[model samples]
Target: MKINFTHKLKILHPFFYVVALCFLSTKAEEDNTDLRFATQPTHQTAVLGSTVVLPCRVIPRDGTVQWTRDGFGLGTIRRLDGFDRYSMIGSNEEGDFSLKISPVTLEDDSEYQCQVSSKKGPKLRSRVARLTVFVPPESPSISPSPEVSATAGVNVTIKCESIGGRPAPELSLRFL
Candidate 1:
């Protein structure tokens, strides 16, 4: 049996089309796989009523980035709604989706992550980064009511204490 050229071409046309489609699809998948976090957010320490930035950057810039706090989504927009202090900093063109919190409060202390989702790839999440907010201690107080007198060659004990401080305040005593 001999097959004509036109018939052979017709039979192979579908196979060639399928092969090309698969190749293109694979290329697209490879490109999506390249989408990754170039810079991940790191642990941050911020003072109460201050501002802080959690850095995050993705390469290839082909995906949507969002910030999550304690596993809760904060949306993918530049500024989060209902959150006056929460916003996204850095340039979107550069793939920097850093989260910024102005006037950080004690409530802002929590774990945060940068998440990236692409059309053709699985969602990517950065390592958890903790935000620690420090609150200054109140005025320290000394026992003995401002003045204490002791006889010569006698030992006197004084106590100093500070209240309402995060991470606890270190206390040191100096004698004048």
Candidate 2:
């Protein structure tokens, strides 16, 4: 028995078409897996010995999350001593990307970047967020003696001094 050429061609053509459709569908799915920032990184400030959270969010939550500091790029956290000081807080369930700094200090104050990337997409970065650390006020002191012994008609000068005070400090004096 001889197979009909046109009949064989018709079946093969449909088979080829189905295979092409499957391949194209996979490509479309891969293309759709793109990393996007639902909420860009925002500026954050913390007192020098306080904790702070920097906010970053990604949509779809189907990508690897990373945290990096100045001069680093597209990296994940590694374990070591004192790792508790810095950490990434978020999960696929919440779709949140955030950085937490505990007992933030001057070292933690710098520009930070949050990166996310899908399995088939390039790494994407959020807007740079700045971490500003404020040093609390120390015990203020008075210069030239807070208490001065003066005789009648004598001129005394009092000066108040402050160190490590945020937003500067206003010195005031009360005379009785």
Candidate 3:
């Protein structure tokens, strides 16, 4: 027994259509590219009342860049909520997507992300960077010294301590 050519074509019509569709969909280079994060944001440390910039760069340089703080809502970084301390620091001309936090305070310490999305291609993203803001210790409270009275020849002892300081702390002693 033999099969007709027309009957064979009818059976394979769906298979041919699928192959053609896949080829057409993947034929455009404008839809996707080698765009990716060239440099990921790294951990940064800043002293209180200072500024810090998190570095980020994309390869293609055509994608739009954005930054998001961890505590804020995940939708977008636009909602200031009376705290617009963060802002973008780079432009398309420089091909940088860094985030700048000025006058760094204890509240500015958090995690941040750099996201890049292609205008005519796919989306790319970078790893998160942590900002650590260091604040100086406040004045200490000395007990018993203010209430006790000492004579000119008598020796007096006092207690002093500084807490909440970072990166090797130091304390000074003075006699009045």
- Which candidate gets the maximum lDDT versus the true structure? 1
Task: Name model 1 segments beyond 4 Å from true.
Answer: 1-33, 145-148
Q: How far off is residue 80 in model 3, in Å? A: 7.6
Give the per-residue lDDT of model 2 (tens digit) for 1-176.
Answer: 99999999997998999999999999888788665888777787788899888877888777777777774653465221355687777775777867778879788878888887677777788888888888877777987877777788988777788887665677677766
| lDDT of each residue in 140-166, candidate 1, tens digit only | 999976578778899999889999899
What lDDT is obtained when candidate 1 is compared to the true structure? 0.90
In model 2, where do residues sit more than 4 Å from their true spots? 1-26, 73-82, 143-155, 166-176
Whole-model lDDT, model 2: 0.76
lDDT per prediction? 0.90, 0.76, 0.73
Query: So what's the TM-score on candidate 2?
Result: 0.70
**Could you give the C-alpha RMSD of every candidate to the true structure, in order shown?**
4.3, 5.8, 6.6
- Output the number of the TM-score-best candidate: 1
Per-residue lDDT tens digits for candidate 3, residues 1-176, read 79999999999999999999888778766576778787788988999989888888777777567776784533323333345666665656657766777789887788888777678776666787888878877667676654567798988787777677755467676665
Candidate 2, residue 41: Cα displacement in angstroms equals 2.1
Q: What order do candidates take by lDDT, descending?
A: 1, 2, 3
